[model samples]
Target: MEKLNVNPNRMELAELKSKLAVAKQGHELLKGKQDELVHRFVDMVRESKDLRARLTEQFSDLYQQFALVGAELSPDFLEEAFLSSGNSANITGSEASIMGVRVPQFDFLLPKDEISYPYSFSYTNSELDASLRKCHRMMQDIIHLAELEKSCELLANEIEKIRRRVNALEFMTIPQLQESIRYIQMRLDENERGNLVRLIKVKNKIKK
Candidate 1:
């Protein structure tokens, strides 16, 4: 640890002590922030994992359903039906703050009449109708999963940044400040002893 360049005097010692106190206080604050950020990050990661798993399962089932429906209908007819369907949504994006980190939020607004199949129901079987309905209903969950994954990414980045800052304060700044304070105190004490000895010698000479 390197000592700061300052005069060996009471004024310098006092200043160093004050600086050390501030440094320690800042270190504690940063450590606290790092811990809290880590906790939240872990929780978000778990949540994202679970959500991803559920979505994956649901998507697998939805894919099989679509495949079955495809087998029953002609490719051109299925394509035409999907193209004519009037399923649409408006997605709105916004921001949310978690422990000073801003993450994204998304919401989808459905039309007043809700999603409707404009395709000819007479030509489509029950399987096709069911698959289309499920696909449209899954849109909200897909958006929610996207939001969670994005938030997790953003939170992870923020936690890494805080960890670096906390490590710097704990391992470098605080230790350096403490070392400088100690060096100044020792110098001041030695100087005080020298001055006292000099005064005693002058008194003895006058007495003689």
Candidate 2:
């Protein structure tokens, strides 16, 4: 026969019940947060798509300009122009937690007035210079959007996972535990009653 290790002290049952309540509360709170995150993530994805389209158009325009400047300017001239523009960009990442999920935060730094390349190059094409500036700005925007989209994805995934775990504990594990506890309590009561009847019978026999 398989031995049943039923907890008679009731301590384990109380502790598990407490944990079940906490798990249920956490599940509800996380579910709400998950819904919010889904909304936010959808918005970010839509924005990302629009931004990517716009960036593609801008890049096509830049390439056409590059081709127009062709034989007259070496590829080095484009590179040198970029360097001479005296603008630099730095991207940094940090972490933040939302509903027990760690998400990434990005910081962008752009420095201005680092180079006097326009006057030095003796290139009178202001339009090309303007296009370069537009490209630089677009690049920074793309980086920021990419980071936001990725973070949104990660947070959404984590929220879904936590929600599932909560559901399993609430709907399955806790109920099963409580059912087992009830069965054990009934069996113990039945055993006590049987012992009491046996003791009474023995007392009557001894009196006879």
What TM-score goes with each of the models? 0.93, 0.66
Candidate 1 lDDT score relative to the true structure: 0.83
- Give the per-residue lDDT of model 1 (tens digit) for 1-208: 7766777778888887888788788878877877887888788788878888988998899899989988989999988877765866799999998878899999878875555786877998888878777877788888988998888888788878877887887788778778887888888788889999999999999999
Taken over the whole model, the C-alpha lDDT of each candidate is: 0.83, 0.69
In candidate 1, position 65 carries an lDDT of: 92
Model 2, global lDDT: 0.69
Q: What is the clash count for each candidate, in the order shown?
A: 0, 0
Which digits, one per residue and each the tens of the lDDT, describe model 2 over residues 63-144? 8876766646667766666665455577898988765667777877777633224444476366566666666667677787
The TM-score of predicted model 1 comes to 0.93
